[model samples]
Every structure is written in structure tokens, then in C-alpha cells.
Target: MARVLYDLYGRDEQLRFSPYCWRVRMALAHKGLDVEVKPWRFQQKDAIAFANTDKVPVLCDGDQVVADSFAIMRYLDDAYPETPAVLGSGVSYQRALLFCHFVDRQISPALFRIVALDLLAAIHPDDRDYFRATREARFGCTLEEFHSPEQGQALLYKALAPVREVLRTSPFLDGETPSGADYLLFGSVMWANIVSRQAPVIEEPLVGDWFKRLCAAHNGLGDQALTVRDLGDEQSA
Candidate 1:
């Protein structure tokens, strides 16, 4: 059995939903790769040292160690091309890159903002004021400036607009079935949901509905998701 060592716990544990990791998870599942998930605490860096990387979501199978999630997904696609993780052929690869590149340029920053606000909210109430002050100083922007709800929504909408367009034409982002683009959109939306409770403001409700559908389709992994440090008594065990 392959062993998947993940940063099950960390300050930014929510990074698990990162487009990078989400793609890997989808790829692995699509390939029917049986894996043993080893949840690692943020402090247990030593535990994953043998995996040859300090990052979580490291995959070890037999004698191979796959570090980065992107690498892992590509490896899975090439090694098990039967199921085909990517959509289309050579030209389709370029199209998939377009989606990934668009996501990197647009959706990711909004996610960062939402995440920062959520982290600030997690601070002690008494310490929140001080924390915001420090954050403002560090970012050269006041809490009020950083916490613009409208701005956050705008960013999210801008990012999601492209995905909506793709979904409008095709059931999935790329075509009939879930493609690399689908995984990217799923990861971004999942990150938005986990990191921030609010929905993005947009004219099209199709995006939100699609997100709901995708969440429902993948709900089994919801509980298994090691986003937060609470794995139901990880500390006790």
C-alpha cells in the first residue's frame, strides 16, 4: 500500500485545499490508488523527514517519494494514463495550463485575503486589536482597508467568472468529465468555503450551484479533510 504523509495539522492547515493538493487528491482517487493516509501534526516535521521534503501531502510508494502535489498528479497521470487525469490531448494540455495560469493570477489572491481575515478572527478577542495593528503595520494597510467585504467579493467573482463560463458550455470545465480544470476550480471554491463562510458576489448563480454540486459529489472526503488540527482526539491518541 502507498503511504501518503500529509500535514494534517498546521497553522495554515487549510492549505490542504490548496489547488495543488486538491488536484493530487483527485488524481489519486481517479486512478483508484489505494493509499494509507498518515496525518502529521504541524510540529512533527521530523516524522516526514524521510519523505525527502518538509511539505505535507508527500506520497511514498515502494521506493518512490513524490513531494510537490503538482508533480505527484503528473506522475499519476503518466504512470496510470488509462483513466487519464488530463483532458484532451497535446493541445488540451495547453488549454489546461491556461486555466491553471488564470487561477494562479486571479483566484489565489482573493483566497489569501479571505484566509488572512479568518486568521485574524481566530486571534484572541483581547489580542485582536493588537493583532490587527501589527498586521496593518506589516501589510501597510489598516484592518479596515484589508477587511473590505466588497473587495473580497469582487476578487472572488473575478476569479470565478472564467470557471462559470467554462461550466456553462460544458458539464465540466474541460468537457464531459472532470478534467484538470475541474480540479483547479474545485480546489479554489473549496478553499473559499473553508477559509471564509461568505459567498462571492456575482450575477450568475450557476457558479454557486455548481460549487454546491461538486461539494456534494465529494462530500465523503469532507470529514476526512485534515484542514484543521482537530482530527477528533488526535492529541489524545
Candidate 2:
């Protein structure tokens, strides 16, 4: 049986845009694992209820079911030890783990504000109500008020300062090579790239170059993702 990856999709089934899901996709690609990505919608909670979680990026490898992206990555690394390692040594692993946490806690929220409205527009119509209610509660504001483009852009730039500083000195967050840490941050940026036309500009030339390199990774997977503007163009004609 083929490994199954349940990925979050947008209005179109092919529009898989979840940052967490992208993290798992990149990690799987990094490990040279082949998977059948199943497009999952926000309203399809019962479909994934077997894993006891409504969210996706769930990996079902035969009888093994993993929910969280980080857990799934660790599972892949541990289960297939001969494959390329996701996490490196003791210290390196810790650093990678820190990047994962930083991307989720610090970077994702800032990027979320920028793409919140665009994301809402991209999701399946059936999921709109559920998405709004849950996200509004979490944000403590209506999506309109929360996703001010200017504010979001500013916050995103501020959040990315440390990342820019690091990339200025090294090609990847893991220094010389792309690692789990690089994928963690790349996934967050890919989230922006997929959902919105406006992306947070990295002031540093090195950071911008690094992002370009990442976009070209995994056989141009990031480059292939359609942005919200691209979707809009399709609808307009």
C-alpha cells in the first residue's frame, strides 16, 4: 500500500496551501519518500476524525496514523533510518526544533495576518462559515479587521528580521545545507506565496536569494503553487 498524506486544500482540490502540510511535503521530499497526497477540505472534519484531529497534514502509513507535522517528520526519520536524516545530531536537532517552533509561533502568525482574507477567499464555500467562526475566535477579531495588508506586511517584515540576519551569514538556516530548519521557514514563506500576491519583502539580498533557491527546490514545487492573484485572474476571464 502507498503512504497516504492528507493535505489541506483550497476552493480548488489542487490548491493545497497549508503551511504545516507544506512542511510535511518538503520533509517527505527531502527523505525521498513517495506519497499519494489526498486533498482535504476544512469542512471534511469527519473524514479525518479517525486520527482524533480535524486538522490535516495527517500521514497514514499502513496502520500507522500520525497527526501533527513535526510528529510525522520524526516518525518518517525514525521509521526509515536509511533515508536521508531530517534532524541531524543532538545540538543540530535542537536547533532545527527551535526553528520549527519559531516558524509556527512567531513567523506563521505574522504571515497569517497578511493572507487571512485571501485564504478565506480560496477555501471551499462549504467551509467558509466554520473557518470564519474558528479563526475569528482565535484572532479575537473579525477577519477584515485583523488582516490589514499594511499592518500585516510590517509585522511580517519585523518577524522575519532574525531569519534575514541568519540567512545573511549562511545559505540555509542549518548553515551550509538545507535541513529541517530550512524547510520549516520555507514552508511559512510558501504559505504566503500560495495564498497571496503580496509577499513580505526580505530586505537583505541574501535572504531574498535564499528564498529563490528554496522556491527552486523539490523540483520547483514552491514555484508551481498558484497564488491568490493567479486564481483571481483565472476567475476574471
Candidate 3:
């Protein structure tokens, strides 16, 4: 049985920069599962039609096809019981879900405003208009009219206060190691890191150091991500 993941990408197929997909990628790595990742673009709805969803981060594990990032992570723990659980049970699971919701409702929106234009510059040409049309409609403003970088950065930092407080003492959200909550927030941060010319930073030593450690986890799976942080100087030069 072949394990495969439909991951979202930018202009360069190698630039798999979808935050949700990154969540799944890290979850899979946590479960010690190796998958062949297929890059999907915004205009490629037909490609994932079988999953009954237009979104990427669809995992086809043998006969089971799981769509949605969070759903896929839950499925991994169920199917591969021997692997490390991405989400703990009881109160732990509920807490993780709560944190995920906070990131989705708060962190993601502000971060998007910061990198929306950078993402526009990076997506496949065929998906450009669709990306802009949908995002602009959702945000109620043209991408160019969206929050300025300075504002976006400030908003991101403010929204990240909870996570920053945690990292100030704990190495990971789940104490010594990572949990579902860590992956959720990491995905949001990766969104800013991968596309922004200058990746948004919140408390350089706190969040910054934690992010570096996350990128190095799962055998450097995320370390391989195509972050503009790596090319920011060249792009500006």
C-alpha cells in the first residue's frame, strides 16, 4: 500500500508552502510515516475531486483517503496505533483543539495579511487570479489594500502572546516534546516564514528559538522548507 499526500505548492512545485500541509507533514513525521508527497496547486481542483474537497493536505493512505489537515492527523493516530500520538487524549486533546482554534481564528489571519502579496508572487501563474479573487473576497479588501507589513507584523506579535508566554519557559507546547498544539502553531509560523521576504518574528529569543528547534525536528523535515528567510537578503539585493 502506497502512502501519499497531496500537498499545496507555489510556482516552484518544490515550494510546498501551505501551512495546513505543513501541519500534516509534521504530523506524519511524528508518526514515523513516510509518504510520497504530490504537489497540488490552487487551480487543480479536479485532481483532488475524489477526496470530495478542493483543499490540499489530502492524505491517501492505501484504501483510505483523508482530507483536511486536522482530520488527517487524527486518522494517523487511529490507524497507526504504535506510532507516537500527535494528539493526546482526555483534557490534553481538548486543550490542543482549543489552541488550534485560537491559531486559526487569530494568528492565521494577521499572518496572511503580512505574506498575502508574497504568496501572490509565488503561486503558479494559472492559480494567480483565483488565489487573489478568493482571498480578497474573504478578507473584504484587495490584497494590495490589506494590512501593511508593519501593521501585519505588529498584529502577528500581539496574536502570538499566548504561544510566546509558553515558549519562554517550555521547550515545546507539550512540555519537553511537541504535541498537536505545537504542530498547529508551527504551521501558522511557517506560513509567515516560507513566503514573507522578512519572516515575521515575535520575541526573537522566545518564539524565534522555538521556531528554529521546530524546523530541526522530525529529522529536519521542516528545515528543508523553502523559506524566503533563506533568500531574503538576495531578494532585497
lDDT ranking of the models: 3, 2, 1
TM-scores of the candidates in the order shown: 0.72, 0.92, 0.93
Task: Give the TM-score comparing model 1 with the true structure, all chains together.
Answer: 0.72
Worst window of 10 by summed lDDT in candidate 2: 197-206
Which lDDT tens digits does candidate 2 get at residues 18-127?
88898898888888888999989887889999999989989999899999888888888888889887776578778778878878887788778877888788777788
Write model 1 residue lDDT over 1-237, tens digit each, in one string. Answer: 555646342333342444456666666665667676664543456887887776667777766788876567666676667876653358776776777777777876666565667545433344467667766887698765676656766787777776778778877765776657777667666654554534342335787666555555444553355343332322342
The global Cα lDDT (0 to 1) of model 2 is 0.81
Model 1 per-residue lDDT at 24: 64
Worst 10 residues of 1 by lDDT: 228-237
Q: What are the lDDT scores of the predictions, listed in order?
A: 0.60, 0.81, 0.83
- Residue pairs with backbone atoms closer than 3 Å in model 3 (clashes): none
Give a tens-digit lDDT track for model 3, residues 1-237: 899999888766677788899899999899888899998888789999999999988999999999998889888988998889997667877887888889999888888777778878777768899988998898889999984777877887888888778887899977898868889989978877887765554446788888888999989987888765554343452
Clashing pairs in 1: none
Better of 1 and 3 by lDDT: 3
Over 4 Å off, model 3: 200-203, 228-237
